[model samples]
Target: MGLFQPDTDIFCHRDALREDYQPDEIVGRDEELQQYIAALQPVINGDQPANVFLYGKAGVGKTACTRYLLSELKSDAVEYGVDLTTIRTNCEDLSTSYQVAIQLINDLRGSENRLKPTGYPRRQVNEWLWDELDSIGGTIIIVFDEVDHIEDDSILYQIPRARANGNLKEAKVGIIGISNDFKFRESLSSKVQSSLCEKELQFPAYNANELRTILRQRADTAFYEDVVPREVIAKCAAFGARDAGDARQSLDLLMEAGDIAVEQDADQVTEAHVDEARAALERSRIVDGVAGLTQQGHLVLYALVMLHEEGKTPTRARAIQDRYKIVCDRAAVDSLVPRRMRDHLNELAMLGIASRVERNKGEVGGRYYEYSLDTNPDLLLEALDETVDMVGVTESIRKRRS
Candidate 1:
């Protein structure tokens, strides 16, 4: 009768689907795993490690596979009597080479000896890093997950060539750069590229079958027997495959469905639960995406949504500009110019909240672009209501939805 009573019906080991939970086996990435193992083979042989770069879309098992393989490599290295050390830090917050150097030094020094965020010269930071690396005096692998987030390539250039540059005498260091941006490699300077791209691997998206295999494994582990049906698994897999080909998305769908079933006091998860979960997730995504926009961005999106509701899109920026000005005035903010308005529209298209199409009118007229909402009208209106005062537009959209 307690409000927070535990429910044993749906999830047995829910942490199985948690982000930090590392699976013992990596499914749907056999080919990539073999190549990755080959790249790490030098570690076991007590040779200088290769600087490996892995590029792929998000949730394609790049980091998960790395963790799985590195765990095994660590085990094997111990048995083989290799002096190996692995340290990982996400680059999402560390922007400059100075920040990265500070982070690496702090990581090597442990939490009790952590460095302050500021008040250090760049050269001194690099020297401290080299000093720490030399102190370790063995093969060390430093992994920069989301490596593209770092603004400068100075660290990328230095780490791989630290020995040749006489920065370190004892320790042999290697870098593992994991990024979701495929173009990040091309953006690197030629010097940095030659060093970091010595060994590169691409992780492709998982198909429906592969997602099914992965979800089935987690479902079996996380839920009691027969709590998750094969049909529900297939539906989740298909939805994930069709949307982003992300294993994480499939797992999220399964987990959300289970939570919904438990909330409803049902005995088992069903396809209807998955459908409800998908709708809820889509709405959450829209809300989150909309929440990140600037005030002007919210105005622009509201204008586009109004146009979409009126069947005026995929219209041109000129049309959206007119409505946008009105929205800006209503919100008591100045409107942006046509060009700046188009920039927001393009950003919306990039975020998948809106769709853009380009048309050419032969050599005389040049090319023009049209824009429209790619998201659900009802959802966008609801999201906009939370961010901006679009009462007139909101009432219109909700009226149609009803």
Candidate 2:
């Protein structure tokens, strides 16, 4: 066998299909682009920047559109002789308001002058942020992507009301809060909500045709001319649209399908390649979702799978709690209280590992939630077995069956 395949030129520029790739153009977001442009128009006209909020499901074009417009705005600002400075930070790991402020201060200051990641009081951090903004002394737009990750809404309130509160004297600041959590906006305090949501835009998921267009555009640049066929692109789009209209998913499917074709020594990516890629993606997703759970979460999920295997699915929380207790006992770990157990179950449901259906018997019976495995029970068991020690768990399950 040869060391390398003779025909492995599946992708031209694979980076084009990646999540971080910032394309020269954004597709299927014309309306959104216009709305975003309108929101940032003030900065172009040398007026005070507007606070804008963007909310949507993951893999939508929220970040992409924001980046595209911000880039264009920065370029135009230079041409128009506007002193525009933009700061962007992802709050995924930086949760608290103080942490976000420290990050912003460090971002404003060069790395040489950056402060430590911790040890600052919230008030001191806010003072430092104000000082940095005052030093910039121009139109400053700060974008907080994954803003919902922030533990406190203090930064949101502080930034938008900086001028009115007299914290910012020279610089005019704008806040752009981006989040995939829809409820995050409403969860904010009324004051923070009123200011941060001054102008709000929602990015809806892309449909099949829209995803197809997006895939085609990236395919032209990502893969060889004939490597990805029209049907393959359509299939990828169909899958993404059927699920969540996630453009990222569509692009990922295309990229992975091409890689699979290359791995199999196939001449080109075909429907079979896409099918294999879909299976691989699903497996990886389930494993990642399972791996992210806490130990108790794993116990709860394992219990659900065991119940499902015994044809006890669509079970209520109380039944799952009982099974969870057994699994925990077998593993020699203490089980959580029923209330906390319910919280863990809800977390699992949020992570897409489990499903919760609300049930109400007529006025005679009270309402209850029915829980079931959202994914394949076999797959869930496989993921758990691989990620954690299931020897005792499997033995306990077997004993119960016997």
The lDDT, on a scale of 0 to 1, for candidate 2 is: 0.89
What candidate 1 gets wrong by more than 4 Å, as runs, is: 312-323, 337-343, 346-351, 355-371, 396-402
Per-model TM values vs. the true structure: 0.92, 0.92
Model 1 scores worst on lDDT over the 10 consecutive residues at 388-397
TM-score of 1: 0.92
For model 2, name the residue pairs that clash.
none
| lDDT (C-alpha, whole model) for all candidates | 0.91, 0.89
For candidate 2, write residues 55-125 as lDDT tens digits: 99999999999888999999999999999999999999988888888889988997767889887677888
- In the range 1-402, model 1's lDDT, one tens digit per residue, is 776977789999998987777887988899999999999999999999999999998989999998998899999989999888999999999998888999999999997778899999888889999999999988899999999999999999999999999999999999999999989999999999999989999998899999999999899899999999999999999999998799888898888999999999999999999999999998998999999998888889888987887788889899999999988887778888899999999989878899899999889978999888899877887788887564366776668757
lDDT of 2 at 2: 79
For model 1, what is the error of residue 248's alpha carbon versus the real structure, in angstroms, after optimal superposition?
1.0
Lowest summed-lDDT stretch of 10 residues in model 2? 390-399
